[model samples]
Target: MKKGENTRKHIISKAAELFNQKGYAGSSMSDITELTGIKKGGIYRHFASKDEIALEAYNYAGSIVGGHIQEAIRQQETAFGKLLSYLRVYVNVVEEPPFIGGCPLLNAAVECDDGHPILRQRAQQGLEGTLGNIKAIIMQGIESGEFKADIDVDALATFTLSIMEGSVMMSKLEGDNRHVRMNIENFSAYLRAVCVQN
Candidate 1:
């Protein structure tokens, strides 16, 4: 990569960690400079404003987490396996997150709501993408005869995302992975029960 591109990525990487951990409002230009060792003028050389950095950082964080989940899903052979893999990824996130903070989508959504419209919209897009992936997996399972035909893909996808996000939040707040693990186990059981018998 070019020198300027490398600097831009460095800024985004450092800024993403700060934003994910301290949040957009909590993280300032000084914090970014301190974390990245880049001057305010240098940061501005790449990003026009803090909002621009926040948006890019949000996208960067989302990509990191999303790529991790996608890789896990790709390793599975079946839709049911992929679904379980998806749940397992979130469970793992409670212990070893892809980013410094927990789920970026949840963090950004909570922090940006009613404050930063752009960041909030980005978070929403990340969530919708996740929901779409889950729904697609369930649809695949149904078409492949692995899951019951009567199952509600949209509702289940929403439920799965909600449970995982809530569990992650609870676990992060309490500094315990039990909540996430238990919820994931329960979700896995639900999937197995719903799956068609071979």
Candidate 2:
């Protein structure tokens, strides 16, 4: 990468960790500069404003997490396996988060809920893509005869995301991956029994 583009990405990477952990509202330009070891002028030179930096950081964080999950899911051989692999990512995230704070989507969604319309929209768009991936996996299972044809794809996808996100939250709070592991295992087994083919 060019020197300028490299500097821009460096700012985004550091800011993403800061904003993900401290939140956009909580993190300030001072904090960003301290974390990135760059002067305010240096940062502003690359980003028009803090908002621009935050948006780029959010996108970077999302892609980091998404790529991790997508790579894992791709390793699976069947649609049912892919669905289980998808849920398993959260279990891994409980301890080894792709970013410093945690799940960027969850953090952004909660932090942006009442304010930061642009960031909230970014979170929403990221979540829709996530849910859409789940639905697509379910549809693939049905088409491949790997999953029961009668499954309600929409409801299952929504429920899966909700429960998985909730589990991650609990795990983060307690500083233990056991809760997430149990939840993922039980849910995966349940789906295997009822949804997956014999």
Candidate 3:
């Protein structure tokens, strides 16, 4: 990569964790500089404003989590296994997060809901993408005769995502992983019960 590209990526990597942890509104230019060891001029030369950086940082963080989940899903052979792998990723996140903070989508959605339109839209896209993935898995399972045909894919995907996100929030707030594990265990059971017998 070129020098400028490297510098830009460096800024995004450093700022992603800060934004995910402190949030867009909470993380300041000085914080970015401190974290990245880049001066205000350096950061500005790459990003026009903090909002630009925040958006990129949010994308970067989301991509990391997304990549990890995709990899995990790929490791499973069956659709039911893939779905469980998806949930397992988040359960693991509650114990050992891939990034510094928790789920970037949840954080950005909560923090940017009222103020930052761009960030909120980005978060919305991330969430929609996640729902799409889950829906695809459910559809695949149905086609393969692994899941019931009558299942509501859209509603189930939304509910599953909601449960995972809620579990993450609760775990983060209480600094405990028990509730997250419990939720995942229950979700796994639900998946097993819903799966068609071979």
The TM-scores of all predictions, comma-separated, are 0.95, 0.95, 0.95
Which whole-number lDDT from 0 to 100 does residue 149 have in model 3? 91
In model 2, how large is the Cα lDDT of residue 31?
96
Candidate 3, superposed: residue stretches over 4 Å from native:
195-198
Note the Cα lDDT for every prediction shown: 0.86, 0.86, 0.87
Instruction: Single out the weakest 10-residue window by summed lDDT for candidate 1.
Output: 86-95
Model 3 TM-score relative to the real fold: 0.95
Off by over 4 Å in 2: none
* Cα displacement (Å) at residue 134, model 2: 1.1
**Number of backbone-clashing residue pairs for each candidate, in the order shown:** 0, 0, 0
What are the runs in model 1 whose C-alpha is more than 4 Å off? 195-198
- Model 2 agreement with the true structure over 118-160: per-residue lDDT tens digits: 9899899999999999999999989989889999999888877
lDDT tens per residue, model 1, 100-171: 898889999999889999888888888889999999998988898888898888998898788878888988
